[model samples]
Target: MSTKIKANTDAFIKARVVKGYSQRELARHSGLSHAYVSLLERAIKSVGPSTAKKLSDLLDKELEELFRIEMQPRP
Candidate 1:
């Protein structure tokens, strides 16, 4: 996977975990499929702006914040 993709996936997973939500819960809350959430977290799929918006809403964060977080270096 590309580094940016990996970074985004990592950020998504980390944010979800920090929110104390399971993948299934996040899927339901974000109107995304559980499998898709898994794929996103695994860096097997790229998230479009719409999906990112849903996730940002579910996380109660700004969309730009989500994008910024996704682009940050992991660890």
Candidate 2:
């Protein structure tokens, strides 16, 4: 099983900015790599459940507000 997170880019960036967290800062506080944070913000990469929750919590936003999560089964 694979889960993909499609982030609401505008909301994600806005929330982070509103919270005064830069990409690197957010990543550091979230215990995620800065590269991954950059990729996620650019929609170049997707995150799993735990990572998604971490970001949402750290950003002080609802999970559904920042991301559209989908679960897909690999063939």
- Candidate 2 structure quality by residue, lDDT tens digits, 1-75: 877897788999999999999999998999989998888888788988888998999998999999987789999
Q: Best candidate, lDDT-wise?
A: 2
Question: Which pairs of residues clash in candidate 2, taking residues 3 or more apart in a chain or in different chains?
Answer: none
Residue 2, model 1: lDDT of: 26
Which window of 10 residues has the lowest lDDT sum in candidate 2? 1-10
Q: Candidate 1, overall lDDT?
A: 0.71
- Cα RMSD of all models vs. native, in order, equals 6.3, 1.7
Candidate 2 whole-model C-alpha lDDT, 0 to 1: 0.90
For all predicted structures, in order, the TM-scores are 0.67, 0.86
Supply candidate 2's per-residue lDDT for 35: 94
Instruction: Write down the lDDT of every candidate, Cα atoms only.
Output: 0.71, 0.90
